[model samples]
Target: MTKTIPNYLRIHRGIDRQDSTNREQSQNLITSFWNSYSDATGWRIDSRASRKNNVLELLPAVTSETPQDHSDEFTPVVGRIAATRLATAASNLTEQVLRTRECLRQREAELASSAAMIGVEHDGKVSADQIEQSLADAMEACKCDAAALYMLDEDTRYLKARSVVGLPIERLENPPRELRGSRGDLEAMVQDVVTIDNMTAGSIDTWNSPEPFAAGICVAIKVDDIPIGTLWLFRETTTEFGSTESAIARLVATNLSLLLRQAPQAEIFDNPQPHQAIQEIAQWQYESLPVGSALAEGWRVDGMIESSESWATGWHHWDVLPDGTLMLAIAEATDPTATGAMHAAVARAALAAHSGYRHTPAQLIQRVSDTLWQTNTGEQLVSMTYAHLDPETGDGIVSSAGSISALISSRYGYRPLISSLSAPLNTSMDSNAANHEFHMLEGETLLAYSKGFATAGADQMTLGGHIRTAMQLEDRSPLAMLRRKLIDLPLTQERGALTLLRT
Candidate 1:
């Protein structure tokens, strides 16, 4: 079929005639003719692509303009050409729109799946093996070829690859160094852009991808403001990532970071365990007490013994020896700063108690003194007090260093026990050690505590006064007296420790 040229090109050629001094008049006439023809034939003229050379080929051989002999030939050819071109244009537009819609649908499905995997339901991995399986499922669902999960190292400065799919797990187990440079050739190789598929890499900017990895996205795994590691997806195509896909990847990373952070703290000694360990630790002290008679009948061990360097808990203890002649023992409970200091004291105590050397309390007290140091706010240390009651004897020894008051009393009445007021041990190691020794006369009570006791919440909760009054009302048995006071006092809510001794 002979195809007629578009009418706009014919008008353009006709208007450009060199003889026309009236260029505007000629162009207007040609435009008017084409417009009238287009209206009658339902054809539209596009002037943008008009050219003089193509004018004859573009003009429509419409019925009204046909010559008598050639009309049959030209008209049918022009009509057929118009029909074919329109069908081709329409088909091309439909195909382009369909492809665009499909891309959107694929991205939406990927996002929904990612959200479901890491959604409110917390169980992603049931076992160590399942972690890899979960990550693999995410990668597969996302249509990424390679994926990796890295953990923030203990120092938190960098991320180390822990689990991966499409890479050897053995190599990912640990990167030589999480830092980019120190990660060496294999890691550094991956960091450089190896494919055109990712936004993180481009013609102007490059980032590493895995070996044999052509393209994909790399998203940082983060929780709160902390960046734990990275999640990487790799593929063969030059995959241009969309905003929604990037967000879904980041969400997966956050879920992974949260799970890893809590795993260790939950399993460690930081939490409560069976009483077996506590019982074993206190076995020696338990054996030293009287067997037949109730050592302190009804004097319940209120809670599990807690270890500390602070003198607040008198039940917890450590042995001390410095320069052989100084043998000392400390018993206390945990404070906010107790964990580290208690461990230090435990090491010192264990060595002293086990060392085959003569021990004098004087030498030990001298070595165990305190030292001054600036606080976080640059303030001086607070006052602290120390007192010792020999487990073997009911005798009490006391020392005070800008500390709370000490109380000594028999069943009938109470009196303040005095010790030479001196600087705390660590404040000045060479300072004179103050020592007060007195036998806990049978049926008498002795108490020493931190300032928390006096500052306790309620008037009736004053630890010192309560213990004194309880002693004054002491039952025939020492155990009954302690049990009565323990159950009756309001000291639990306020922060303080009370160590009671009776002969």
Candidate 2:
């Protein structure tokens, strides 16, 4: 296919032109043609293109007064010779582009290698200083005389110079903030890569540079496409950056972004206070839930929970009455951020007191709610789902304190076991308690879960509806398979207890 590639729109333009020698050769050939037919032709090479059809045309820049004067004599031999030069020029420019791309790919692979090496170590691997050192090494590899690394503060939009070589601190401290009141050039952070040769004052803020400004490249350090900071490299001579230089800068920015992103983990690990606190809370959060096994005559019940850094859930102890009623409750604190172990413990005690054979699922939750009101359970509220099942008859009853609805799967169909939403635990006893009853066919399953389970691990409606449609009548794997799938989901950070009863 032919690209227009006018003389002005040629690939060999500015810094992108790689084959200066070939371009000069092509220009000489055109001049030679004008000299050969100088007196015979008013022909000049006016419009020109490095053609894609394996050919080149040196038209006579004149009226058709002498239309057939020179065509017969020179057209055949000149066309062949011109084709050779055209191919050479095109091939050279094409090679330049390919070379730039290959270099960038190699740089990316090198960055990945650096990341893998750092990933092997824990505490010292992702520190901010490590990032600065890595970036400095990258600067050396990129062959820049001077470079600086800037990282955004935890709460501030402006960037601060973290590390630098061959640059003054006063001028390089802040690049740009992409804000109105900020002092630096906003384009430095907003654009992909900005390069300027012979930079002056006010334009790029190179006015304060120690040596006379020459050339510079700036790129934003981005994570998941959002700019976090800027990386700058400067040269001492008047030379514009090419694609290869810009690409290397981008790759360096990417590596810096990843390192900065992981820096928080390093900080947490190096500081013993937050480290110990995280370990303790993580232990309490996971160990607080009973996920092993809950089995009785004609019932097989099991559950699991996974929490993010921000939220955790505690499940009430399972109840297996003498009548083979398998009861399970999953609870989440009203304030999603609070990891309220003591509050969950109090609610579990109340639930255990009434979860025996005498009380129905609705009645048991009602009693727990009343206890929360009367006792010193504080102003805390909890959302919970309590479900009890008689696996022998495939019969079950479910009650919720504004918890997620249960999912029922069988040969008939698979979907969320729809139920009415109700008040949470610690509500007034007078508030109505809603109950949902469900029956399962042979080899069917009933899965009850907390609010976190509904959304975190997967889309609530989509997962439930998929289970409903794909459920097998004789499947034995209850919630275990579902739990594993949930754990693999990116959004499953706050996934809570999931209890399943199989008939």
TM-scores of all predicted structures: 0.33, 0.46
**Tens digit per residue, CA lDDT, model 2, 425-463:** 776654355677887665566666666654554555655
All candidates: CA RMSD (Å): 24.0, 16.9
C-alpha lDDT of residue 460 in model 2: 59
Tens-digit per-residue lDDT, 40-72, candidate 1? 544444446544633322344344556767754
Q: Each prediction's Cα lDDT score?
A: 0.43, 0.58
Question: Positional deviation of 425 in candidate 2, in angstroms?
Answer: 1.8
What's each prediction's clash count?
23, 4
For model 2, which pairs clash? Answer: 43-61, 44-61, 414-468, 415-468
Best by TM-score: 2
Per-residue error for 454 in candidate 2, Å, reads 4.6
